[model samples]
Target: MLKTLYKGFILSYLLITISCTTNQNSSDLIQAIDNRQTDKALRIIDQLDNLNEQDSLGLSPMHWAAKRALPQITKALIKKGCNLNITDVHGYTPLNYAIKADNAEIINLMLKNQAVVYKNGLSNLSDGPFVDWTEKGLYAYYLKHDSISSKSFLLGKFINQNTRYFKGWNGDTTTYTITDNKIPAWEFKTQEPIFVLGDIHGQYDRMVKNLQAHGVIDKHLKWSWGKGHLVFVGDIFDRGNKVTEALWLIYKLEQEADKTGGKVHMSFGNHELMVLNKDNRYIANDYKNLCNNLGLEYNTLFHSNSVLGEWLRSKNSMTKINDILFVHGGISQKQIDSGMSTQEINELVRQYLISGSSPKNQDKLNQILKSFGPFWYRGYFMDRSQYKKITEQELISILEALKVSRVVVGHTENDELSALYNGKVIDVNIPLAEDSIPNQALLIKYGKFFRLTEDGNKTLLN
Candidate 1:
């Protein structure tokens, strides 16, 4: 009996020792995977048989490899029969990591092993890193395909799958025929006037109020006033709780107008470009929250490839109707003298507007910025005399070359209502402050001369 008991004790001891050793080896392999030591991880994985050993964080070696984006290590672990469906602490499976990392080879391997694509798991809100990886993977997949239809489909899928937190404004779905001619026939009619709306800064309530006052919106949010040829002078975002709502509403209106032979002309604004560049960090928290609610990481929806950003980039800096020139900011003489045609200037504006935070080429970007700066200048407008002081007759020469009686702009905020400068330019930034009398927007009727007045009243220019 004594001998038997001693033998039993020895067997228990051996079993414990083996278990400890196995656990230690598994931990070492996990550490290798975590450190992205792909070869070492592979070698360690090869020594294991069960492949079910969990790391300190309870992640399997395969999960570790996938999180680290070590494709080779993942492949080796797969060869060792690592479960492709094994999820980490955050509920992200190995395939999730592979997709997020843009590791197509590893993704293919996991998919071949029957990895799931859409699984309802624990929320990834706290797992910022993993969420980032996932977005990157989706973006990469779209990039790889590179077809407009494919891209649109993939983006819709991504939004549908992820962005359920906030209400999305789907622009009016009506398809409008693009007028193939130079200018639409409706633009020439004097009786049908076009109303130019200044920067809206996401004040949706104010926008609705102004539009309603101008007979643009009815009580039911329907278009009822003017010819519907509303020129929105950009800066539709930042500084308000309703930017998304405003954008969606405007997008719908734009589409509606287009369908009815009306139009919504937009000029690129600096704030839109600032957000596009990600330089001005003081973003509206509501907008940020909207992105988070949509399951998009911060900066994800406003990046270089963002739909809004791309659309802004494609807009013309200025529009010429008859003898009048409409630009968000006035252009300088140098742009005209560079032997650039109107089409070339428009293309240049597009390039500057689209080149986000870190431009692909610095020197090329600088050249573009210098030329596009005229239509994007704010400081120069603060001191008109400084234009001559800095550029030394260059500004005047450019203005003369453009040859319009007056350049209409909306960048400088004027407290004294509207300010006419040099008898050649107009600054129509309406002050929306409570202490000040409400200012007005300038409306130039197609066949009639220029006029300015308060929101509800009109005064003809003599």
Candidate 2:
């Protein structure tokens, strides 16, 4: 009995030791991937006993590699015969993540490895692609050409409001319209009524209703505010599942408003810049699966080569209307010191997006992309260890430099549209597109500012 007990204890100890070592190596591999140490992750994977070991997020090394679009690391993992079809905690396979990244090389690698697209019986396509588009419901077929371009032929079937429809590419550039990709003037001195809203995190339905109620759009969701200006202070990406729909709505409104002698301005926000830069941390799961079905990445949909992508590039980073400066984030004193005009700032941002910043302009680009930059600075609300408070004198100097009386900003979330610094700075970033309930926005008309709600009620503010 004593000898048997000794053997049992020895076996248990060995198993526990092996388990601990495997867990440690697995953790190290994940950390390497997160830190973007591709070579180190590859090395760890080679030494790892179980390549499918998951981290707390239930994503294995393969999933992370594919999600981050690290083609070399993905190839290394494939060579090691890692399980390609392993699903993460989100019920997404490695191939799904690769598709989300829109990484063609990695996606092709996974497909060649026989990564499963369906789990049990339903195709991942059944989950849908756009806001109100689903394969199962519409019997939608994947087009040979992914984008709606003049050169590519589009063929697909869809159902809207229970009406079955088929759309065939006519090879006409007019059929699939690409907006005139020209940057518009950012400075305006208009007396027409202005409606300004904050970050719209992909809540398309809520945004349409909010605009409709405020008399910006008519019943058909077309721009009806003739000669009036509608400004969206950045952030029409990520979070909600209807980002694509919201973007299309804005795109349509922009064109219609232009025809009616009105203007629709979408300033670049932090999320917009982040998405354009290929940062997909905050993207919704719906988008991941949708992109998987589309055989593209999220950024690819808005890349310089695509239609909406070009339109987005044409947008400004900041706009000034009648002494009121509208920016996604408030300006800092450092930005004031930079002395970049509104047009220069827009031009620089556009250049950076197109080809990245030149080495000579690296220092200036750093300041622009920093937390204290135009689309990110929140010093007007409060200061932190990283962001110091902008004093009243500093604010005056910034406004005077920009030749604006007040600055209106979004990004700092507030319960309602409020004023700070004795009404010098106004925040319109209420809970708008993040939820289903109606939210308020800032309205500037008749030389007075007011808070406009979805019910068309306007309350004067300073």
Candidate 1 at 275: error in angstroms?
2.4
Best by TM-score: 2
lDDT of 2 by residue, 185-279 (tens): 99898999999988888877788888988889999877899999999999998887677668877887888999999999999999999999998
Residue 12's lDDT in candidate 2: 99
Model 1 lDDT per residue over 1-462, tens place: 999999999999999998887777788888887887777777777777877677656678777777778878877877877787776677666666666676656654564454543333223211111011134332211101112311111112222224322222233232221111122221122345667667677667777776766666676666665354676666776665556556656655665666666666777666676666654454566445333222233344444454443445567667655444566666655446455555455666566555532555454345435524544655325445334322425545555666555556666666533434443455655544333545355566644434434455676543
Top model by lDDT, which number? 2
Provide backbone clash counts, one per model.
2, 1
**Candidate 2 RMSD to the correct structure:** 14.8
All candidates' lDDT scores? 0.55, 0.76
Candidate 1 lDDT score at position 322: 49
